[model samples]
Target: MVGTAARVTVAACIAFYLCRYGLDAAVMALYATFTVVALGVLARIPGSGRQRAVTTLWVLPAGTALVVLGTLLAVRTWAAVLGMLVIGFLVAYAGSAGPRIAGAAPGMQLLYILPCFPPYAPGTLDQRVYGFVLGAVLLAAAQVLILPEPVTPPFRALLADAAEAAAALADHHDGPAPERTLARARTAADRLRPSRVPPADLPASPTRAHKAMAHAAETVRTLLAQLAALHGAAAPRGGYHAETVGLLDGIAAALRQAARALRAGRRPGAEPSVAALQAGLDPVRTRRAVAALERLGVDDRLVFLRRRALVVQAADSAVVLVLATRLLLGDRGVGADRAGHAFAYARTPAWVLWWRRLSTHFTPRSVIFQNACRFALGLAAARAVAGVLDLSHGFWVLLATLTLTRTTSLETRWVVRQALIGTLIGAAAAGVLLALVEERTTVYALVLPVVMLAAFTLGPLRGPAWAQGGFTLVVATLFAQVAPVTWQLAPTRFADVLTGSVIGLACGLLAWPRGAGSELRRSMAGVCTAVADAVGRTASRVVEPSAGPADGAGIVALNRALVLAEESLAQYQSEPREETARQPDWPAVLAAGAHARRGERLLPGRPGRIGDGPVGGWLRREAGRTAEGYRALAERLRTGGPDGPRGAPTDPDAPQLLNIHGLLEVVPPPPPDTDTDRAAAAALLVDAVVWLDTLTADLRRIHGEMAEMARRAEPPGPRLA
Candidate 1:
């Protein structure tokens, strides 16, 4: 619907333009009108209002301050200086935030507004000269009145995340049991998504929700992992593992089904399999869970079901707020149809998603600091060019300025190279577009969507850089030819854009940066260290599930490790050096990681790290038979396989375990204090010492690079709220 609406709207708009104005004129008007509409939409977003107000308040003064400072510093006044400041502010802001932040969304919207501003505009009256400002305010008010409460994708996403988290937690405590843990986990995840209308649209309690949700998630993960082990072991179908996996297959079903059931205002005749699935991990969680079930006034099953329903409601509401914000702000006004198609494609692209997920490991703050210095250099370039150049049609340069993609010098230099190629092609294409501009303004209208499509097709699928060159041409051509002859304007515009990109790009390359390899290597060490810690900790008496810092897999902690491993592999693969330094191949890493995770998950009880004291020792014993699990993981990470069996360690007695606890602490007296006793103690101590030393050595070797990166990089930019 979004895609169709966008395309049709453009077609209708253009058709209207053609009749109301000459072809050349209508196309310009269309671009102008769309640009205004898009900016109006962006101004409605939450933080953007603050950012805009701040920027509006700051830029003029900042510009003045800089001008004075530079003059005092003996710097020359330059026309391009203002443009450089604009780009700098943008990079700083966008780079500071996560996807949820208002940074990039607003930055992208700048493209729409730029073409309407003085430097780029063709002496046409600023649209705001009319009642456009008042009209926009009125439109905003109407939309707020009409738009339904936000609940949509963000809410669904939140619900899903909460559910997944709960499932993870259940795994850690109760673990999977046919009747209890899975169903309980599902209920926990589902509770946030409600069907009933909320009261007063009250401010949400996000932090509280996050904590509860995190706990539940940990439980669900622990159980599901155990469940997966059972399946891989080819254990029987009706066992806890089978049913647990069934629950995982459609986590949302419990809430989705329950919502319908609730809205129907009648008890469901037979709940979907999800209710059963939600309880899959309960048997091991300590009898407290089961006891809690009995204590509730509702039937045991219904109690769990109702709990999940609440989760669903909360999750749904959060998502609504997020998506509502996006709809209002993510406008660059290329064309509503084109923008819609781009967003649809961008949001759902399978490959892009894989990449985005990979990028999530390195926080946005890190990315900004990583790129800022280089981008600043690019800004300098655009500034110099803007001041010096005089091309008849120069916006292409500005467009070209925005075209380049940046990554570690190793990752995909091709992205940068391709952008350059696209720009060259687009420049050639722009000549044709310009010629047509004289005869038909509709030609520029044709140019706008085609440029967007071309940029989409030729470059990275999303982001500002992709279609910049083409769109630059659209703006440059329409204004230059249609508004009357202008030779100097184009050159200045092109140079201004070019210099900004150059400055930005160079700063990113330098600025005390660290390579991702170093980061990944450190994560590798940390992953090993964590495993060792988990193993060693378990050596002590088993911490009761109900008592202590909780039991089972510190599954969330482990997930973080896995996420790091996954992230490392991506960085490794994405950033292969020009020659030396063996890049860790991601697919290989993923395969190895799978086996390693299986080994950890398989341990009946929570495992501890190697040499993690007595508790770790117990954890090691439970993690897998022998020290083989750790040894196997270490080997596979370096050179080998996902070649291990599941369920091989079931019901093992003492020595059959690797006995990390035994290594860490004195076992019951070995015998009388004769030669035998002395020899035994000495030998054990020596062995323990050797193992500890080796483990630490291995850890440092694996993660040395990552540590170095943290030391070198700038303080991470302010995190987007």
Candidate 2:
């Protein structure tokens, strides 16, 4: 904060002195300093010095175009009004897809207002541009050189925290469930998104450590859950092998290395091996455990070991990939193969792909396209009003309208309230300062540094409303130096802001009406469907690993869906209560996703295709049924119907599941040599059946909870309010 304040103060004062010395173009330079500081400290993107410099360079050309267009339109009253309306709509529409685009909208609107200032001397335009470039460079340099903070620290901390949580899960420490621990990890990871450059890949970006961290955390959580479930459902009645305990310790050791690597931002050193544990499984003991479990018609420990091994393998692979991202070709080391496969279709002919993307926007379902039109319409209306009033600086009205509107009505209303209140407070403060001092220019110069310093400090401390107030005061003071400062100026500015706010609010509520609550529900439903699809696919893999290893695409889709759902939920929670929206059990939904992912990781690329007859058949059938259950749940979420499993829930330990128990515990067992491989395969088949059955039951329960959520009609209390 101190660095930012100092930089802003230095930049603004320099610009002011240049302007006082007859470089009249320094006015824009002053604004540029504010822009650079604001984007550096407040905005999410263009975070690094290089990225910010690039973004600023791009903004110059783009902003210049808007100014030229505005100047052309402003010559004729009708053209100016019409242009404002159109420009307003386009900027608003462009941002309907997400917050990043929405954030850029204000800057676009500011460009439109830039040309509305009094005409400059011939060649003074170049001077202003030069001033802007100079200020931007100085500001960027300050951020890069002054007590620079490392970009990786916060991200490293997030990964380290998640790894510790995973280790705790493996140790069966008493605390939150693995699902809850992972969710917190994911939440933290989200905040760790890289501030500077755009993410290099979709779903999971190899260049983004946070993405890898979040995914690894989920994998660990799932592994722990599988262990817990197997322990609960299949209590091996005999003495446990010390090897099993050692295997768990090995997995825990790998997790510790993962945490250390993430903290150090380097590749992991040689990790503990599970090979010793694998060797310790005496065939005689394994045979007895399998036989005893089969006799009891329960899950087998050997089967659990096989499944656990798969998860450990996946988790270790993920951690290694994250650590390797810093090396040469690091992004491609472990995880890049999957990422490449996911985006291989992008290699299609560029023209064809571009055409398809463009065509998508023309469809009726394209909310972004429709939003753009609505924004234009709203701006037009606001411009017409401003034109009729013919107030001093009528463009301010259009600026307000453009700045106030957001993706949702609720958000627009909130912004309007803040902008209006802020403008009033700022105008009053500026008016007082102008009136109090006998030496206006001297007081203005003295106060400029204080205001610039305060703007940086107060904007973050207070919310957007207070920030807006500071912004208004700065603008009023700057303009007063170039033009006349009068008490009437404050009221006139207030009227302009009021007019724009009303127009923005009206457009938000009435045009193509979509509330945050509705968007939230829709996003949540999408997440449910995504989870269902992953569960179904995983069930297939468990039933028939020989078909192929579980694809990474399913988990990727799950992650993307969850991110969208979380974003929509945040927007919804920030608004007033609405009818037909209920508090969703997000944790339950998240847990279901975790289960699906775990199930996927549990399957091997190659399972024994030749298995014992009846046991294998039953396993396949159970897996199919589990897939069907997940599909049903997905359909229910999409359609919002109550059709779920019609009959009572089946017992996980029922007679059907115990069928393998009878086969293994026969009074006269088959020849020991012949039954060795067959017995192991049969035991694994039984475990698969139990796991699928249990997963399906959990899916059904989540489906029921979602159904109940759908039925909620009354408005709930507003958490954000």
Candidate 3:
């Protein structure tokens, strides 16, 4: 905050001085000063100095375009209002592309708002553009040359650290102290959870590399869970099976190599390919071990089979991590492979990716779309009200609306109340200052920078009230320097802010007032449904390879649903809510979706296939039951019912949905045969069992968490009861 304040103060003061004194241009000076505040304080572009400089440079052209558009539209009130509506929506919606765009969105809106007011000044367009360009250039330079912000660890480095942690956990899966190892593994996994990761560090872009990185993070979490499960499983008397040990060692090495590759920025074509590591730890060995256990007629055959299944599941997760990492490193070969369907955009053109990102949020169901609409309508209404009322400093109305409006009506109300109080206090102080100064331009000039320094430095550190109050004082001193001002200016400023707040509050109530909280539930349900469809489709393909190539549609749907759910969760976390509000365990819900998608991706890619037989028929039935379970879970989420089981079944021995452990215990193994087909079928069945088990565990965890939250949300029963 200190660094940003210092840089903004230096750049803005310099720009203001150059335009005011050197050029004697009041319009240019005003624009130049506000430009610095808009870009520096309002739009907080995150990253190192160089990254922010580059981002600022990119934003300049957009800023210039908005200024030109605003100046042109200022010819009439209706034109400016319409322009505000369209431009506001576009700028806010563009944030769906990436963090950089999202960070610059507020500044872009301010650029348009500044010129689209009563001045009707196409004649001053040149001055506005010049001042904007100057301020932007100066700010960009200041970002790099003036007390640059300290660089934080990069997101890729975080991912690398997670991979290294997972590697360590894998290496000691059978350590003497299982509890300690499991705790460490869980902690490492939690670090990669979306809720735990910083928003600035999230790879949420639609580009291939970002998507791949996100998938790799989720896969690492899955791998850690598998390893933790292995650690907790009762070890055989002679220790882990030879195949399990080999696979664990192989997985550990592969993870270490991945971490090194990430840290070194190695390309996908680098030596010792992660994909090849899968071949070295072949599932064939796992199948042979299962066969040997069955042949020996060991009393602990079922336990050994379960252990082998876990090892296979771990190997599957490792393969996904390998593929995702490869894609992140720009491996087009992986995109061309059959498994690339999971990452369809890995090789897509940039323009197409942008289009997809925008189009995906075009629906009313999307929180981004809802936010854009709310923002646009609020700003448009504020502009229209200011023009109709012929309010002085009309842009202040727009600015108030821009800053005060939040996703939820409840939050907007809270902010509006604080802002109003602050504006009132600031107005009174400004009125006193104006009365005392009485046309002393020098006093105003001297105090301007000090006030600016204090305001910019403390506003954000404080709350919206501080920001509103400090900003009110800033505009007062600024306008006093530009021209003559009286005590009346304070009241005018407060009145404009009040008008904007009213408009913003009205829009908030009329639009999606509940914010992502409600949408998050719907999105989670959508994700569950998509996962169920994908799981059923993948199981079908596994049961019958000739069921045609795996339909990419289900994968795409699941990906889209997961993306939307994640975005909603992010917004929901930011919005204000009552303490007693009933909310699902969002992180757990997200994990369940990720697990389902990962299972779908891994099912068809396993080493073997299953033909229609007793085993295949049983697998199909189990898949149907799993799909039904997810569908039921989705229904429960939507209906706001308890996420956990409602009550014990009338028949305790009846087969339960997602009870893979019980099902596997009773499932008949493939008939004894020396042929490879039987062995392949047995291996495929094991993969299905493990995948189902993992998914079931995730669902149960989500259920338990949700049930707890629901219980907490319930009010105390009547004393009479």
Indicate which candidate wins on TM-score.
Answer: 3
Which residue pairs in candidate 3 have backbone atoms (N, alpha carbon, C) closer than 3 angstroms, thus clashing?
A: none
What tens digits encode model 1's per-residue C-alpha lDDT throughout 130-156? 222322333233333332224333332
What lDDT tens digits, residue by residue, belong to model 3 across residues 1-721?
8789889988998999899878999999988988899999999787778778888889888999998999999999999999999999999999998887899899889999999986787889999999999999999999999999767666677777777777776776453335666676777677777667655667878777887888888788877877777777777676766666777788888888888878877785663255555675555445654564364345332455555566666666676677778778878677655456566667677787667777888889899999999999999999998899898789999999999999999999999999999899999999999999979988988898888888888888888888899999989998998899999999999999999999999999999888887687778888888878877887888888777575455666777888788888888777767653555566676666776777666667655667776657777777787777678778767776322233311232232544334445545554555656656666666667656665666666666665565555557887983
Residues 1-721, candidate 2: write the lDDT tens digits. Answer: 5555665667556755665545665556544544454344433332344444455454566555665676667666677667766776666554433344455556666555555433423244554455555655665566566543334334445546655654654553232335665565445444344322133111222223434444544544444444444333433345234444444455556666656666666553343222333343234333543544444434432354344333333333333323332221123233333223322222334454344334434433345455566668777777677667666667667667766776578678777887778878987886776667534766666777788778766866775576667766666666666666676666777788788888888988887456444444455566657765665565455445545443465765665566555555555455553343345365566566655554554433323332424544555555555555655544444554212222212334221222344344432342265666555554344345444545655665665555454445325767894
Task: Count clashes in each candidate, considering only residues at least 3 apart in sequence or on different chains.
Answer: 127, 5, 0
Order of all candidates by lDDT, from best down to worst? 3, 2, 1
Question: Model 3 Cα displacement at 328 (Å)?
Answer: 1.7
Residue-level error in angstroms, candidate 1, position 604: 18
Q: What's each prediction's TM-score?
A: 0.45, 0.68, 0.91
| lDDT score of residue 97 within candidate 2 | 32
lDDT of 1: 0.36
Error of 3 at 299 (Å): 11
Model 2, CA-based lDDT: 0.52
